[model samples]
Target: MTERRQSVQQSPADWVARQAELYEESGGTEGTTMRGAPCLLMDYRGRRTGDWRRTVLIFGRDGEDYLVVASNGGADNHPLWYLNLESDPRVRLRVLTERFDARAETLGHEEKQRVWPHLVEVFPPYADYQRGTSRDIPVVRLRRV
Candidate 1:
């Protein structure tokens, strides 16, 4: 049997590390909620290093797909995970205790427009994040592979 690789923690924030630990150690059961909303763990290969990196993100459901925002708290650029996914769309997602393979797709303007409201409803701060930055935030849909 092939050995499983441990995920590398890339975020400098203490909470991120802590949250990831709590979420992962519990098989995504304990720390499944973030900011009072459901969260999922996304694992992707780093764009440059090619190492496995994971992050916990709040998500909204789009039928069978999951919706995630690249707001980076309204920063001028996209989040690292989003950028990594851009380089490689293949990823693994953990929702609660279940794990699955998925493919990430950046939504175009028209599709983003159609899905934006549902996202905003799920996480109200998304609207505020958009207003805080001039750059258009991207909303990615993670479809099951």
Candidate 2:
């Protein structure tokens, strides 16, 4: 039998919640872009509550995989979503109107070196965000399962 998935909640941030709502409500036709670039929705389980959590993230393609930056806007700590995924890598992804199951993997130093430039090309502000913080922001690769 298939495992039963946990129920999820929208982010506490008002804008994030609204964005996720609109994205799903429109079946990914709307809320698919952020800052003129393409974006995708990631649904992960909360590490603490075991509830579902969703976030809209800007992404870049690596062949069939998807790349996402956990910059947290240059904050010292990693984003909650990233931390949650660390404990459990299984996740749900929505790219425009397509939905799929994927597993998140944190890229290592060498991999980061290779992919950093490509990510910057997709979202230039990622460069600025990295420069603003001392912590090494994580670049995650969501591979299809």
Per-candidate Cα lDDT values, in order, are 0.87, 0.91
RMSD to true structure for each model, in Å: 2.1, 1.5
- Top candidate when judged by TM-score against the true structure: 2
Per-residue CA lDDT of model 1 for 18-66, tens digit only, reads 8878988998779888788888988888889888888888899889999
Residue 60's lDDT in candidate 2: 91
Off by over 4 Å in 2: 1-6
Which window of 10 residues has the lowest lDDT sum in candidate 2?
Answer: 1-10
The prediction achieving the highest lDDT against the true structure is 2
Question: Lowest summed-lDDT stretch of 10 residues in model 1?
Answer: 1-10
Give the per-residue lDDT digits (tens) of candidate 2, residues 101-121: 899999999999899999999
